[model samples]
Target: MTLIHPAEDLGVLRFITAGSVDDGKSTLIGRLLYDSKAVLSDQLSALARAKHKRTAGEDIDLALLTDGLEAEREQGITIDVAYRYFATAKRKFIIADTPGHEQYTRNMVTGASTAHAAIILIDATRVSEVDGRTELLAQTKRHSAIVKLLALPHVIVAINKMDLVDYSEARFDAIRAAYLALAQRLGLQSVRFVPVSALKGDNIVTASERMPWYQDEPLLDVLESLPVGEVSGSAAELRFPVQLVARQDGSHADDFRGYMGRVEAGAISVGQALRVLPAGHRATVAEIIGPRGELAHAHAGQCVTVRLAEDVDISRGDILVAAEATVEPARKLSADLCWFDHEPLSSQRKYILKQTTANVFARVGSVDSVLDVGTLSHGQHKGTLEMNDIGAVQISLQKALVCDTYEQHPATGAFVLIDEATHHTVAAGMIRAFTA
Candidate 1:
């Protein structure tokens, strides 16, 4: 056996497990934790007490481990994104178990935005009436579309409930073929198919004896072997948003005056030059300090106080980027909107547009079209977007925002629209290239 070198090991693989309600998403996660011994004895005792059993025996209702919410337990469905952390000998994992219902698509988006991979479960036993057809669910397709849009590097299509289908290889093959076609059409780069029985523990933690015809790595094995994705810095240009002005405003004000924020992308070195966005001021990095102490360099995700060579009037929402790779500032942006509110959007009405750390007043200029997840087709212009609608929209911002296209840089490319009075987030949007 070849030993995996320490340098090659990816510390953790963040992934999301999503599918329609009652598709056994919670059970699968519980099974993974229980079968892999990730669950504690106390958790097992609690599961026993909950009495959410599929059968009458000592079989613990695995879903109870993730369905922690009282409402979820009562209704027998996941209403929000439930995150769980577990690890195996090979690699660590952060699992986001997102809700499957179409109404909660926004929750799924929130969970998957930072994920490196997506495990979309398909209910193999779910059959249609009339003639007994088992096509993929529309929700599954919708999740896939979102995952594709998020640009998750890895995709795993787990055909679940194989036991209910008598562990038929033909059924799994058919579903695999159909899903593969969908993946190709959606331009999903890397995709793999697996047959599993989340309830019976087939192809999850261990290889099942029932599916003898299949010979491949189990679901956990695939997850274990997948390479961790690169840091955001590698995916996009440098973008450092100033969250605060780190100043004592007292005796140490002169010594402690620095810009405090996260390195959203790329690295920062002591002597590197940076251009402050919106302010259009140039400065050189004089120092970088972290939580521990001083740092010569800082990379993406590291929150550090950056000292500049010159005192530039930088405020919250101002970005520090490489002078060579500066992005364009625009007030009008064409973007794809994921409307989460029950109230349909009105083009003439004013709303709050929050892009990055900046919040400005805005209004919808146009609703070009709505996308049909079922057919992967775009429909004619809809005047308003109802709840859980995905469409193309034009937004006019009160102030210009330095931004990039979602295809170019996700950090600056995505934003949310909020109601003026309620302050509730009504829509999430991604830049679709056109900006002015």
Candidate 2:
């Protein structure tokens, strides 16, 4: 079976699909891959003979392409996050097909954490006008809230199953207006709406003649044209988390004492002044060694070993920043925590907080508030967090950590909590403020 991968020279776009259960997200993605000719003949043949075909005879069930698990196929639902890759002539794309159930909210959050955009599908039949007001599903609000929390650069609201509604323009308009209101409330920027029928392949890869009133670029065009801002190599602040320290023969005339890591944010060059974080020791960059040997300069996303003019004490988990930057080492943090484990979070339990290359013991000092997805509001916390619950909390750490707010630099601002006993990841956190 041959697999098709995107060309190396083309720009890549990574996005995730989210919606309520049975909202046709899998079908939309399957149709996208199929129409783009990413599927191979052997895979198509297997799909044709598959026993869990949902479509009528001789017509393949495109959704089967994404719902790969035995149980998912039988249940006609997506449970885990599924990733698919395809490319058009213009751009390469990575699509994360995330689960839609409320119970799988954690899975959706995991899928969206690294995505540049999110395609939120809204089932047409499930929404309607009541008392001169348009009402949407709870899952729709829940997923949208998560997208806002993640600060995804773009949002594409795909009103799916348009064919089922006879492609009504008024129905689409009402849903669009209601969604716009929700987006404004959640502070979601760069939101675009499109009406589509994933099953019938209308307005997915090409323009749909059926919806002549809807005059805009199709879904694929919107995706190809969306600005993927600062993917890498941008002028953002410098943040280098030391993953390893390379050393060689100290007694030798030409000794090596280099700090090795990926440049998470801005650029770095030889002779540039740098300050070692948590220690506040200052040094100057002397050399940078890339995969191809010596490099005079390096930017974000480039992994290299850097030699310092003065070798101050440095180790793994130490951060290097600009000399003039203001950073404080704090033992307490105000953060937004998303609980992902089956076991509820207890304030008395201790977990290892893993951020960038640093790992430190941490415990929940207080659960301040819990997010109400239904209302898009924060309510008083009940003192503990269940699975898929998000809340604002104060965390106390065993050691001081130097970092930035999530809105400023996501690399150093985000972290995950690991249960010390089981070594399982329990939650994801975003830093908001440093406290005493």
What TM-score, over all chains together, does every model reach?
0.94, 0.94
Tens-digit lDDT track for model 2 on 4-65?
A: 34552346789999999999999999999988788998989889899998988888889988
Give, for candidate 1, the lowest lDDT window spanning 10 residues: 126-135
Clashing pairs in 1: none
Q: Report the Cα lDDT for residue 421, model 1.
A: 82
C-alpha lDDT of residue 48 in model 1: 82
Cα RMSD (angstroms) for every candidate in the order listed:
2.7, 2.7
Task: Tell me how far the alpha carbon of residue 278 in candidate 1 is from the true structure, in angstroms, after superposition.
Answer: 1.1
